[model samples]
Structure formats: C-alpha cells, structure tokens
Target chain A: MSPELARFLQDCEQDFQQALPALCQPPGSDCPAVPGGLAEAGAYSLGNGGKRIRPVLCHAAAAALGAADRTRSAAPAHALELIHTYSLIHDDLPAMDDDDLRRGQPSLHRAYDEATAILVGDGLQARAFEVIAGSDVLDAAQKVAMIGVLARASGMQGMVGGQYIDIHATGTDMDLAALQAMHQLKTGALIRAALALGGIAAGASEAQLRALDDYGRHIGLAFQVVDDILDVDGDPSALGKTGGKDAAANKPTYVKLLGLDGARQEAQQLLQAALTALETFGASADRLRELARYIVERDR
Target chain B: MSPELARFLQDCEQDFQQALPALCQPPGSDCPAVPGGLAEAGAYSLGNGGKRIRPVLCHAAAAALGAADRTRSAAPAHALELIHTYSLIHDDLPAMDDDDLRRGQPSLHRAYDEATAILVGDGLQARAFEVIAGSDVLDAAQKVAMIGVLARASGMQGMVGGQYIDIHATGTDMDLAALQAMHQLKTGALIRAALALGGIAAGASEAQLRALDDYGRHIGLAFQVVDDILDVDGDPSALGKTGGKDAAANKPTYVKLLGLDGARQEAQQLLQAALTALETFGASADRLRELARYIVERDR
Candidate 1:
C-alpha cells in the first residue's frame, strides 16, 4: 500500500472516531437520558476497530472528485459506517448468522443483551439518515440525493434483501449467478452508495457520478470475492472473527464455485475493470484507484 | 367522529394501503429476486390492520395547514406508518416485548421468523426515509426537512430511546415524570413528527408548525395515558391483541403511576390542552380537534 493511501485512511479513522459518539447520542439540548445506556451499546459496536473501508472509500471518492474540502464527505462516510455496523449487529443475532463474536470482541448481542443490540442497531440506522439530513456541509438537494442513495442501497431491495436471500440459501446449492446476485445486494449496494454519496457530496457531474458508480460496482463485487477467499484461508486471529464459517454452513461462495485460483483471477479482472472506470478522472482519482487495489489485496 | 374527519382518515388509509405493497418491493427493473420472500413478509406486517393514527395525524395536520392537495402529504404519511410498523415488529421480538400477536394476528416473528422480522423492520425504516427522499411531490427542501423531522422523531432520542427506557423500567418503579418522559419519547415523538411532517408538507409557517407541535405533544401523552387505561380494562378482542399485558409484565404505566381514574382524568386534561393548542387555527383544525377527542375517547 502507498504511504499516501495509508495516511489518508488514518486521517479518516481519526475523524470518524471523533464524530461517532455524537452520532449515537440524540442531538440538541433536549436530549433525554437513555437510562438503558443505549448510546453506550451503540458506541461499543460502532467504536469497535473495523477497517473503516467504507468511510475511506467515501473520503477518497470525494477527494478524487476534487472537492475543495474533503471533510464535506464526513456525513456520508460516518453514515455508511453506522449502517454497516448496524447490519453487523443484526447479522450477529442468534436468529441471524448466530455469530457470538465480531471485530475481536463479543458481538453486540453477546456483549449487551439481545434487546439492547436490536434497539442500538435500529437507532444507528435512523442516526445514519438523520446525520445526512442534518449535515450543515450539504445543501438540501445534495442531502436529498445522498439520502436517496443511502436509503435505496440499505433498504429492502439492497442490503436487507441480499441478507434475506443469503439466510435462506444456507445449506442449499446456489449457482454462481445466485451467489453474485445476493452479494451484489447484501454487500455491493452499500459499497456503491459510498462512492455515489462521496461524489454527491463533492458535487460531481452526472457523468462523473456514473463513472463512480461503475467503479463502485466492480470493486464492490471484488471486495466480496476477496472476502470469500479470505474466509477459506485467512487467519482467524487476523480476521478478528471466525473464518471458514461459510463453508461450514454450506453457503455458496465464489471460491467454492470458481475454485480458489479462479476467484483470484476474477478479482484481478474486476480490479482492472474498476481502474478502467476511473480513467476519465485522471490523477484526481489516484486515491480511488489505490483504494480499489487495497480492497482486493487486504487480508482483513 | 365527525363525518369529515372519518372520511379524511378513510382516504388516508386507502392511500397508504395502495402505496404500501410497492414500498416493500425494490424499485426498478434490475431488481434481484429475494427467494426468502422478504417483500412478502414486510408487506404482511405493513398490511395488517392498525388504526393508522400517525398517518391520520399527518394528513390532518396538512389539511389544517390548508394544503391545496391532501395527496401532497402522502410520502410523509406513509413514511410515518412504515416507521410505526417497523417499531411494532421490533418491539414484538422475543428479546424485546416477546409478544406473539399484533393487530389480532401473529406478530411478524411469529408469522415468519425472527431473522426475517428483524430484516423487515430494518428495511421498513430504510424505506421510510427512501420514500420521503425520493418523493416527487415534495421539493428537495421539503424532503430534507421532512427527513430531518422523521429521522429525529424515530431515532435514538425519540421512539427507540423511549423503548429503551420502557424496557429497562419494566418490573420497576417509575415516577410520573419518568413515565411521561418515557412515553413522550417512545410514542410522543413520532406523533409530534407526524404533525410536523404534515405541517412541513403544507408549507406551514413557523408559528403554525409550533402550534401543531404543541397540539401533538398533548394528544401524544393523552394517547398513551388512554392506552394504559385501556390496558387495565379494555377488551383483548376490541384491542385486537392481548390486554392487561402491561400489568402482567409489570411494566410501568400511567395506571400504575396515576391510578385508573387518575389516568382517565389525565387523558381528559391532555385532550383539553391539545384542543387549546389548536384554538388559533379555529375551524381549519376541526379534523385535528376531532381526532384528539377520538384519541382520548376511542374504545380501542
């Protein structure tokens, strides 16, 4: 990884950490005390040290679009992370993936109670849209556009729909087409929204937005493909969660259908396609390009 | 009920029912098939027969503000219902309220499964914001403003936070202030948002909006106080769900805090206050006034 890309990610992490606690809290002086300590539980899951890939991608996309202030991307960046964290919290419930661990710590449900986990997840999702709608850095049009993108990506037709397909497909045979379709919605939609949100925040032209969408689609799938690969071989300690659970659960995956070498080749081709999509932006898109490479190459 | 208010509510219910099925489905032709039938599960809960109180409040508020076309309020009205339905679904989870029934039918988790219930709730919340953000009826500013109101009202500090407090306060002692505060958030916030959303849709002036908010707060508390009163003596058949569950669960309630007759008197007082709040609007707020009285007097 380039030092510049690493530094950019580091900065995003710092900014995100600073902004996160407030996101979980109710805004304004009239905030009622949540005697249940909901904010703490929300912060616990949100503050867990994930890679912050979505936020980094958002910031990079804005910078790539030549936004005068990359901080304009902060609202969407944080919103994406909140949405991602909420999905993780719900996914870890006993009725969902049933995982008891996440991000090297007890899952929100395991750490807190199941009820608190559920409310925290619900609160986080609401907070995501609230933050975007309330962002001072964004105009009304921009806020509406970003909210549209984020909502569609995270809604029934997007992440939640994908999850619906995945949970049902467990222990069932699924073709590569089926696998791709599920991942596209479950994981790809939000990833695509991240870039689109960043572009919207930066006031990118419609054409630029389309180009970012293309780049996002390719890398989104590539990210999932690489995730399948890592699940098969990545160290559990490094991954910070159980690995190979997919295979154990008999869920279909790119690695299972395409073979390890084939999945690797697919990811490489996707990386190439993602770079091609960014060609129109020239040097301004360097961060996006590096981030795409990092997405596929990173172990965790 | 006045014929005018009844007809207005009927129209709102019809509009909401017609728009609801589509909300659960993905928009656009490229939608992937969700084999888990998530859309159906979402539609089931949404389609269930509820009082449509929030949407009615919204439409009434809009009408009171003299919107030329009541349909202009559809997006926010539907969004409010979606948010309300989502909360009910989550609140019924085994980890939360653990009820097996809602609206005279099996609760979402009971009807489908826990995972699907959680996902549908999550999806509904996302779709609420999505519909508002993507509404053609509302301008960008209106959409942004409505999103802000809805998101804040339904968020951590609002409904979810209130639920957090209610769940924790179960089987414990809570004073009148604590009970009011909890009810204000859990139920009052959304009720207030419903009115605010309607007011915004109608382009209400600041003072008019404040009047609607004040009206909402009084009736919002009245609604809950009556709920506690009904829970103590209302028929399960009329209520369409188990009754007396609050006392059975030892959850804090107005009845417990204020006594039955006291709670009924409190509802009457709140109803009067709510009516006073709308005095400035005169006959224009007749629907709202009737609704407030209905809220306090209704058997359900």
Candidate 2:
C-alpha cells in the first residue's frame, strides 16, 4: 500500500462527499415534482452515507493508468455510485432485505412509503446511465463498452441476479458454495465492474482489462466474505446498521456455511488471490493492492 | 404508410419473430443463481404478442431521417422495444393494474409470481441499456445523449412518476387536466423519446428532432384516448383480452375524465396536431403521418 495512494483516495473521498449531492439530489433540492417529503427521504440517506469505494476504485484505476481525461471517468464514476446506492434502496425495501436502518439512519423505505423507495431506486438507476452515456469521455466504442459493462454487472447476470438468488434463499438450507455464488453476483460483480469501467475509459489493453477484472473479482468476493464474518463477530454499533440480520432471517452466510474461523481463512485466501492478480501490474497496482487489504480489514 | 416504409418495418417484424426464441429463451434460463427465470416463463406474452409498434416507430424514425447508419440504430431500436415491453409487464402486475391477460396471453407476473415480475421488469430495464450502450453505431456523446433521453422518459420524472400519480389517483376524485398530465408522462414521454433517439442517430437538427418529438407526443396521447374509447365500445374478442377493466377498477381514464364522446374528439384533435407537426418535414414524414392516423383509429 502506497501512502501517496492512500492519501489520494482520502482526497477522492472528500471530493466525492461533496460531488454526490448535485448528482443525486433532485435538480433542485426543493423541486415539488420529486414528491413531498421524498427530498428529505432521499437526501437523508444518500447525502451522508456509504463507503464511496466504487467511485474511489474508478479514480484509482484511471489514475494508475495515467489517464488524464476526467470527462471519460466522471460519468462512469457517478454511474457506479448511483447503481450502488440504488441497490441499497431496493435491498432495504420491505419485500427485500427489510432492514430498518442503513448507515445509522432510517432507511428510505422506512422513512418514506414503499412506493417512494421503489421510485427512487428506479430514478437512480436511470440517472446512472444518464451520467455515463451523457459524459463527454471516450469514443463511441469505449462508451458503448462502458454501458455494456455497467448494465451486465447491474442486471440479471450480476447484482439483480444475486439479489434474486438471495431473495429465493430465505429460510432455505444452503452450502458454502451456493452462498459464495450468491454474494459473487450480488456484491462482487458490480465492484468488479467499477474497476473494469475505469480500465475501459483509460483505453487499457484487453489483456490489462482482463487482469484488472480478475483482480476485481477476487477482491469483491473477499469483501463480501469479510462482511459475512463481520456479521457473526463485528460490533453493529460501529457498522452503523444492524448486523446478524442474515442469521436472524435464516439467510445463509459464509460464516453459517463455514465456521466463523473458516470464513476468515477463506476471506484471506480471496484477498491473497486478489493480490496475486495485481502483481501482474507491479507498482501500478499499489492502490488496488491496498484496496484489497482494505476490503478484508477495517471495522466497516 | 409509405409501402416502402411499411415493408421495411414488416421485414424487421419477421426477423424478430424468428429470433424471438433465441432472445427470450436464454440458455441458462433455469439457473438458480438468478432469483427469477431470465428465460421465457409462463405465457410468453411479450415476444409473441403486441403490435411491436414501438420498434417499428424506432426503425421508421431512423429510416425516414436517411441515417444510412443501420448498425447504429439497432441497439437503440432494441432498447426502445425493451422499455416498451417492460412497461407493459409492470403495468399488468397485480400491485399495479392487476390485469391477468395482455395481448390475449397471461401477464408476466400473473403467469409467474409478483417477485418474478418485478425482477423481470428490472432485468428488461437493465438489458435495454446494455444493448444501447454496447451498440457500435454511435459515438460516445451520441450514446450518452440517447441514454439521457431514455432515462428522463422512463424514470421518475417520466413513466414511473406518471405511474405513481396514476396509482395515487385510483379511487380518488381527479380532474381531466390531472389525468392528461399523468398519461402524458406515463405513455407519451417514451414515444417522444423513441422518435428523438431515431432522429438524433440520423444527425437530425434540433428543430427536426423537436418536430419529431412533438409529433410523437401528440400521437401518443391520441393513442391512449382511443384506447379508452375502445374499452367502452370495443369487442372483447377483438381486444384479445379483457376489456372494461379500467372502468371496473374505477381508475381515471380519458373517457372517465372527459366524456366518452369528448375523448374521441380529443383523439382526433391530437391526431391532427401530430400530423401538423410533420408539415415541416416534407416527404420524409409521410409514414409518420399515416401512423398517427393509425394510432387514433386502431381497434386493438
């Protein structure tokens, strides 16, 4: 992990914290067309939450490749954030995850009607494309490729598929392989896509994009393994939301399939594989290397 | 319609009908990793039924504008079809309109499950972008703009927003103006967008695009008005499904808001307005003019 890279990511975090509002909040915060109380309903949750890791991954990937075209990466980055946040909204819906809290605040569906939550998710998903497709970056080929990447990652083959699988798994018995497959689609694919899009915008060679995708896949799976373990052991207060909901719901988890200790070992193996892929890039991957470690570590 | 234009659309319809199985019956349709069946499910209403009028409109828009760029419009045309089909799926959902049949076949959700229908809608929406963004026919900027147009028309400020208002209006005493506003967003916006995308792909001037959009908006509203009128007087067998459901649900409609006779008058007026917008386009809009008349006069 490079100190400069870590500091750069921190700065991006600060910048993202600032840029997200205009990208997300209604064209005007007070616009009545957005529905009464939804402004607060939307703003309260999206305004001050999330790890912002997806955007960070985009920035780091572009920066590492010496790509200076901010325009190319801007929309993709925003698209990533939008997709991630929108997923949170839907996952929190009563018919979905039904979690009452997110980032230590009342979830959007909880603070607002179930309809509003569904609508917000719909809006955010559309806006994600508007940001990327509307951005002045990349050639037609790259832009088209970018949309394909994001769409597939977020669509049936990826996040939505994962959610669909998880939704169907409620109170069902599942083994470790099935649980891993579920998380791979739900969480891992989109995260991998974030890195892939950065490479796409940067004009990385197919081989390089493939390598980064491999890295993203490993790290994304590792990230979820850590999440599952944290559910069994980490403090909920620090997580800013309830943990153990998976267990309470009889939802399967890596820790449930594997013992608590076994889950940690598996996460380490994924983190190692992720690091191995980054080794192909040597010093160019210093940030990604750190990102992998960050996934398996930290209290969040 | 110009015989040439009609032939072209008819050709596309023939091609799509043949490929429909490949498109609808994904290879891993039975994969449990996906929450819903991405493959064709019960009733197969979407691919086999409907006029496929929206896709025809997209192709017509591109062809009439002299695109010479057949490849570029493929993604956008397919995207338009997906969005149109997804709207039908959601509109027929139990939580929405609760229609059991569409185009003489069982609705997607009713034939499946509520959650499957929701997931299908989400998948279609996601896949639409994948097709558009991945298309090689347009530049990044063009693709981006097209995406923005689709998003605005489909998301909260557009189709979904209009849906919320419509659902909210159920059993409520709403006026004609309010009803018009709702339908404009729900139905007309997407039609306008489809024309705009087609024109944009052909490098249409802002004025040309605007005129096409204006024509689309007018005819779209007219189409809905005629639909409501048909519900009142249409033969159930010809309708190919249940009629009078909207009235049975006590939902607002053009006929409900305006008198039944008035709805017909409005449809005629709107059709003329649509044709009038084409006066600026010379001979290129001959097919569009014919289509507007068809929209107002169609029985199903």
Candidate 3:
C-alpha cells in the first residue's frame, strides 16, 4: 500500500477504536451500563478487532468525495462496524454456523451463553441505528437515508436473508449463481452501504454516489471470493479463525466451484472492475483504489 | 370502552392487518421473498393477533394530540408492533422463557426451528427502523428522532437489558424496586416509545410530549402489574396462553412481591396516575383515558 493510504487506514482504525466503546453504551444518563451480560458480551465481540475494513472504506469514501467535515463520517463508519460485529455474533450461534472461534478467541456465543450472545447481537443492531440517527454531523435527511440503506442491507433483503440461504444450502450442491447471490446480499450489501453512507454523509452527487456503489459492489464480491480462497489455504493462526470448516461442512464456495486459480482470477477481475468504477473521481479515489487491492490481498 | 375508542382500535387493527403483509416483503423489486422459511417465520408471529396494544397506544396518543393527519402515525405504530412481536419471538426461544405458545398459537421457535425464529426476530427488528426511516409522511428530522427513540427503547438500556435481568433473576427472590426496574425496562420502554412516537408525529409541544410520556409510564407499569395478576388468576383460554408460567419459572413479578390483591391495588393506583397525567388535555384525551382504564380492567 502507498504511504498515504496506509496512514489513512491507521487513522480510521484509531478513530473507531476510540469512539466505539462510548457509542455502544446505554443512551440514557441514568443508566451507566446495560444491566447484565449485555455490556460485556457486546464489548467482547466489538473489541475483538478485525481489520475494520468497513469503517476504513467509509472514511476512504468520505475522502474520495471531498467531504469537508470528514470526522462526521465516523458515525456511519461506527454504525457499519456495529452491524458487522452483530452479524458475526449471530452467525456464530450454535443454531447458525456453530463456530467456536473468532478473531483468535471463542465466538460470542461460546464466550458467553447463547442467550447473552443473542441479546448482544440484538443490542448491537439497535445501537447501530441509534448512533447514526443521533449523529449531529449529518443532516437529518442524510441520517434518514443512511438508516434506510443500512437497515435494508442488514435486514431480510440483505445480510440476514443471505445468511438464511447460506445455512439452508449447506451440504447441498450449489451453482456459482447461487453462491454469488448469497454473497452479494450477505456481505456485498453492507460493503456497498459503507461507501454509499460515506457518499451520503458527504453530499455526493447522485452520479458520484452511483459510481461509489458500483466500486463498492465489485470490491465486496472480490472480498468474499478472496475469503473463500483463504478458507481453503489460510493459516488458522493468521486468519484468527478456524479454516477448512467450509469444506468440512460441505458448504459451497468460490474455491470449490471455480478452483483456486480460477477464484484468484475472478478476484483480480473484480479488483479491476472496482478500480474502473472509481476512475471518474481521479486522484481523490486513490485510497479507495488501494483499499480495493487490499481487500483481495489481505490474509486476515 | 367508549364507542369512539372502540372504533379507533378496530380501525388500527384493520389497517395493521392490511399493511403488515406488504411491509414484510422485500423493499426493492429486484428481490422476491426471502428464500425460504424466513418470511414464513416472521409472518407467523407478526400475523398472529395480539391485542395490538402498542399500536393502539400510539394511535390514541396521536388522537389525543389532535393530529389532523391520523394516517401519518401509522408508520411509527407499525414500527412499534414489529418491535413488540420480535421481542416476543426472541423471549420465547428455548434458552429464554421456553414458551410453547404465544397469543394462543404456537410460539415462533416452536412453529419453526430455533434458527429460523432467531433470524425472523432479527429481520423484524431491522425492518422496524427501515419502515420508519423510509416513511415519506414524516420529515427526515422526525424520522431520525423516531428511530433514535425506538432503538434506545428496544435496545440495551431498554427491553433487551430488562430481559437479561429477568432471565437471570429467575428462581431468585427479588424486592419491589428491582422488580419494578426490570418491568419498566422490559415492558415500559416500548410502551413509552409508542406514546412518544405518536406525540412526535403530531408535532406536540414539549409539555404535551412530557405529559404523554408520564401517562405512558404509569400505564406501562399498570400493564405489567395487571399481567402479573393475570398470570396468577387468568383463565388460559381468556389470556390466550398459559398462566402461572411466571411463577413456575420462578421469575420475579409484581404478584411475587405484592401478592394478588396488592398487585391489583397497584394497577389501580397506576391507572389513576395515568389519568391524572392527561388531566390538562381534557376531552381531547378521552380515548387515552378510556385506554388507561381498559389497561387495568382488561381480562386478557
């Protein structure tokens, strides 16, 4: 990555790390914390620390859009991360993917009980929108639009729907189209929202917003494709999750359908397409372009 | 109930029945229904007829505020009902209350699998905010504010947190203060939001809004107190679910702390408090007044 891109990613990550704890607390002054396991469960999962790719993408989009008050974009960025973390918590439930490990530790359900995990996910999801709606940075309209976009992406039509399809399709033979469709909703929608939220926060023109969405869609797919590839070839320690579970569970994946080399080629093509979508923004989109390359290349 | 209040409730119920189906479908034309059991699970619980108390409360508040556009309050009312339904679905999960029935029908997790029930609850919660944020009737600021209020009420300082406390306090002795705190968060928050959302929808003044909130709080506590009394004395058929489950689960409740007659006396006192809060509104709040009485008097 370029030095500038690297520095920008670091800054966004730091901002998220600092802002997230306070944001996840109960809104009222009377309540210091959520009454029981809620705060601990939420804090555990959220603090586990992934790459914060979603938030970085949001901040990158803000920069790319020439948003004057870039710090204001933090609200949407925080909201996206909260949504992502909550999805992970739910996905790791015994009734769902039943994963034991995440980010080098036990998944939320395993770390806590299934009930606490469930409430934590629900709390996080609620907090996501609450934070965005309450943000002073964005105007009311932008916040409303952001809420609609995020909710639609995270709800039945997006991540949750995709997860439903995924869980049902396990151990079944699935075609590429089916796999792509699931990934598009499950992961792609939030990623696309990350950029769209940034653009919305910045008051980007409709056309510019569309281009950012296009760029986001391409990279979103690429990120998932790479994830499938990594699952087959990744080191468990580095990945901070158990690898080969996909194959063991007989889940359909890009590597399984397209083969490793073919999947790599697909990711490369998506990387190019993502870049192409960002062409109109010229130098302003440099960080986004770098981030696209990073999505396909990241090991964790 | 007065004739006017009865008619208003019937209209809200009819409107809800008509609107909920379309509301559950995917927002965009690009996607059809969620692949499989997702839609069915959500529909099963949401379609099952509850008293629609939250929606009625919202509508009554709107009417009390003299909001000329009664139709405008539909979005928030619907949103509140969705949140309430989703909470019931989650609370019925095997790890939680482990209920087999809800509103005289099979509980969501019992009717479907646990996984589907979990996803359905998540979907409904997400859809609530989406519906509000996307509503064209309210301006953006109102939408944002409504989302914030609903999210905070439904989330970690509110319903979810209260559930956490209740579940943990099961089979344990607790005093009146702890019991009230739990009930206030578990049930009162959403009830409060229902009235608050309605008031906000009508562009109520700060004093009017605070009065609505006060009325809502008194009735919210009354509703729970009556519920505990019902659990001890209600007919299963009349209540539409088994009674005595709260005692059976060893859950903390008003009856456990106050005894049957004492709980009833508390409900009556709360009803009076609720009525007192609306005194200044005079006949404009007649429906709300009737509703407050109904809350304490209702057999179901």
Candidate 4:
C-alpha cells in the first residue's frame, strides 16, 4: 500500500471515530446525552475496527472528481460506514448468520444482549441518513440525492433483499447467475452507493458520475468474489474474523461456483475492468485505481 | 367521528396502500419486481390493518396548515406509516417483545422467519426515508428537513431509545417521570414527527410547526396513557392485540404508576392540552382536535 493511501485511510478512520458519537445524538434536542446504554451499544458496534473500505472508496471517489476539501465527503463517508456497520451487526444476529465473532471480537449480540444489538443496528441505520440530512457541508439537493442513493442501497431492493435471497438460497442449489444477483444487491449496491455518494458530494458531472458508478460496479463484485476466496483460503487471524464459515453454512459462493483458480481469474478481470473505467480521469483518479487493486488483492 | 375526518382517513389509507408496494422496488432498476418474498413480507406487516393513525395525523396537520392540496403531504404521510409499521415489526421480534400477534394477525417473525422479519423491518425503515427523499411533491430542502425529523424520531433518542428503556425497565420499579420520558420517546416521538412532517410538507411557519409539535406531544402522551388504561380495562377483540401483556410481563405503565382512574384522568387532561395547543388555528384544525379526542377516548 502507498503511504498516501494508508495516510488517507488513517485520517478517515480518526475523523469518523470523532464524528460518530455526536451523530448518535438526536437532532434538534437540547439534551446533553442520549438516554442510557443505547448510545454506548451503538458506539460499541460502530466503533468495532474494520477495514473502513467504504469510507475510503467514498473519499477516493470525491478526490477523483477533483474535490479539494476532503471534508465535503465526510457526511456521505460516515453515512456509508454507519450503514455498513449496521448491516454487519444485523447479519451477525443469531437469527441471521448466528456469528459469535466479528472483527476479531465478540459480535454485538454476544457482547451486549440480542435486543440491544438489534436496536443499535436500527439506530445506526437511522443515524446514517440523519448525518446526511443534517449535513452542513452538502447542499440540500446533494443531501437529498445522497440519501436516496444510500437508502436504496441499504434497503430492501439492495442489502436487505440480498440477505433475504441468501437466507432462502442456503442449502439449495443456487446457480452462478442467482449467486451473482444476490451479491449484486447484498454487498455490491452499497459499494456502488459509496462511490456515487462521493461523486455527488463533490458535484461530479453526469459523465463522471456514470464512470464512477461503472468503476464501482466492477469493484463491488470483485470485493465479494475476493471475500469468497478469502473465506476458503485466507488466514482467520489476518482476516480478523472466522474464515470458511460460508462453506460450513453450505451457502453458495464464487469459490464454490467457479474453481478457486477461476475465482482468482475473475477477480483480476474485474480489477482490470475497474481500472479501465477510470481511464477518463488523470492523476486525480490514481487513488481510486490503487484502491481497486487493494480490494482485489488484499489477503483479508 | 366526524364525517370529514373519517373520509380523510379512508382516503389516506387507500392512497398509502396503493403507493406502498411500488416503494419497495429498487430505484433506477428495470427489474419489474423485487427478487423474492421480501416485498411480500413487508406488505404483509405494513398492510396488517393498523389504524393508519400516523398518515391521518400527517394529512390532518397539512390541512390544519391551510394546505388545500392533500397530495403535498403524501410523501411524509406514507413515510410516517412505513416507519410506524417497521417499528411494530421490529418490536415483535423474539429478542424484543416476543409477541406472536400484531394487528390481529401473526407477527412478521411468526408469519415468516426471524431473519425475514429483521430484514423486512430494516427495509421498511430505509424505504420510509427513500419515499421522502424521492418525493416529487417536496423540494430538496423539505425532503432534507423531513428526513432529519423522521430519522431522529425513529432513532436512538426516540423510538429505539424508548424500547431500550422499556426492555431495561422491565421487572423494575420505574417512577412517573422516568416512565413519561420513556413513553415520550417510544411512542411520542413518532406521533410528533407525523404532525411536524405534515406541517413541513405544507411549508408551515416555524410557529405553526411548534404549535403542531405542542399538540403532538400532548396527544402523544395521551395516546400512551389511554393505551395503558385500555390494557387494563378494554376488550382484546376490539384492540386487535393481546391486552394485559404489559402487566403480565411486569413492565411499567401509566396504569401501574398511576392507578386506572388516575391514568384515565391523565388521558383526559392531555386531550384537553392537545386541543388547547391548536387554539391559534381556526376551524382548519377541527380534524386535529377530533383526532386528539379520539386518541384519548377511543375504546380500542
């Protein structure tokens, strides 16, 4: 990883951590704090260390559009991470994936109670949009656009729909097309939304937005394909979560549909596709290009 | 009920039902339908025959603001009901209320699975904001404002916070002030948001929005107080839900904190306060007044 990209991610992580607590506060309230453990539980899950990939993608996309001030992307960046964190929390529920660990630590449901985990996830999802709606950096139109994109990506037709399909498809013979469609909604939509949000925040042109979206679509699928590969072969310690659970659960994956070598080839092709989409941009898109490679090549 | 109020509510219900299924579709997609039963489960819980109180309150508040076109309030109205329906679905989960019934039918988790229920609730909440964000009737500023209001009300400091308190307060003695604060968030916040949303949709003045909020707060309290009373005295068949569950679970309630007569008297006082808050408005607020009365005086 380049020092510049690492520094950018580190800065995003620090800024997001600082801004998140205040985001959990209810809007237009004079109260000094949220009532009880609700906020704490929310912070616990949201602050759980993860790759912060979505925020990086958002910031990189904005930079790709020649946005000088990174702060303009803050609202959408934070919102994307919050949505991502919330999905992880919900997906870890006993009724869902039934995972006991996340990010190398006890999952929210295991650390707290199941109800707390559920409510905190719900609260975080609301706070994600609330952050964008109350953003001072973005104009009203931009805020509206970002909210529409994020909500659609996070909602039924996107993340939730993907989960629904995944749960039903478990233990069933899901074809490659069906598997790709599920991942497209499950993980791909949010990744695409992250890029779109950054572009919207940066006031990208119509063509630029389409290019970012095209780049996002390839990387989004590539991210999931790599994830499936990692589950089959990556070290759990480096991954910060259990690997091989996907196969254990009998859920279909790229690694299962395609041979391991085929999955790796698919990832490389997607990385190239993602890079090709960014050819229209100059040096400003270098970070986006690098991030695409990282997404495909990261061991974790 | 007054003829005008009944007719208005019926119209809101009909319009909301027709608009809801389409709202579940992924934005900007050519897909003719949602991938699976996800939309079906969302429709089932959302169409569960609740009173449509939030949507009616929204439309009524818009009318009270002298907005002739009720269609202006449609986005917020639909958003309010979607949020309300999502909350009910989440509240019925096994880790939460553990209820098998809602609006006289099987709860989402009971009718479907827990994973489906959780995902549907999450989807509905996202779709609520999407409706407002994607509204043709509202401008960008109005959409941003409405999203902020609805998200805050449905989020940590509001409904989710209230549920957290309720879960923690169970089997423990809670005082009047503590109970009121809890109910204020759990139920009051969303009710208040309904009116505020309607007023915002109609481009209400700041003072008028405050008045609607004042009215909402009073009636919001009144709604809960009456609910507590009904749990003790009303028929389950009329309520369309199991009554006495609060007492059965040893959860705190107005009836438990204040005796049944005190709770009844409290409801009446709140109803009066709600009516008083609308004194600045003329006959345009008649529906609001009638609704306030119905909230406190209804048998079910």
Task: Give all TM-scores, in the order shown.
Answer: 0.98, 0.88, 0.98, 0.98
Best by lDDT: 1
TM-score of chain B of 4: 0.97
- Model 3's CAPRI class? medium
Q: Could you tell which candidate, 1 or 4, scores higher by DockQ? A: 1
Model 4 lDDT at residue A130: 89
Report the number of the highest-DockQ candidate: 1
lDDT, model 1: 0.90
Residues B1-300, candidate 2, lDDT per residue (tens digit)?
A: 457657776787775566442443333552223343654641254565577767667766776687663565767777777777777876776556778888877778667766666666676778788767756667766777788788778876677777777776788887877777887887877888889888878788888887888889898889889889989878899889778878898988888878888898999999889988888776666767777777788888
Q: Could you give candidate 4's per-residue lDDT for residues B1-300 as a string of tens digits?
A: 888878877887788777875666654654324666998888787666588888889999999999896888988988888888888889999999899988789999999899999999899999999889988978999999999989888888888899899988899999999999999899999999999999998889999999999999999999999989999899999998888999999999999988999998899899889999999999999999999988887999
Candidate 3 stretches greater than 4 Å from native: A27-33, B30-33
lDDT (10s digit) by residue, model 1, range A1-300: 999888878877787787886677665785565544998999888888598878888888998989866669989999999999999999999999999989889999999899999999999999899899888979999999999889989988899999988988899999988888899999999999999999999989999999999999999999999999999989889899889988999989999999999999999999999999998897989999999999999998
Off by over 4 Å in 1: A31-36, B30-36
Please give, for residues B1-300, the per-residue lDDT of candidate 1 as tens digits.
888777777877787788886688756775554444898998898889599999989988998988766778999988999999999999999999999989889999999999999999999999999999988888999999999889888988899999999888899898899899999999999999999999999999999999999999999999999999989889878999788889999988899888898998899999999999998996778889999999999999
Give the Å error, residue B119, model 3: 0.9
By TM-score rank, best first, the candidates go: 1, 4, 3, 2
Docking class of 2: acceptable
* Interface Cα root-mean-square deviation for all models: 1.5, 3.5, 1.5, 1.6
Write down the RMSD of candidate 3 (Cα, Å): 1.4
Answer with 2 or 3, whichever has the higher lDDT: 3
For model 3, state the Cα shift of residue B48 in Å: 0.3
Q: lDDT for each of the candidates?
A: 0.90, 0.75, 0.88, 0.89
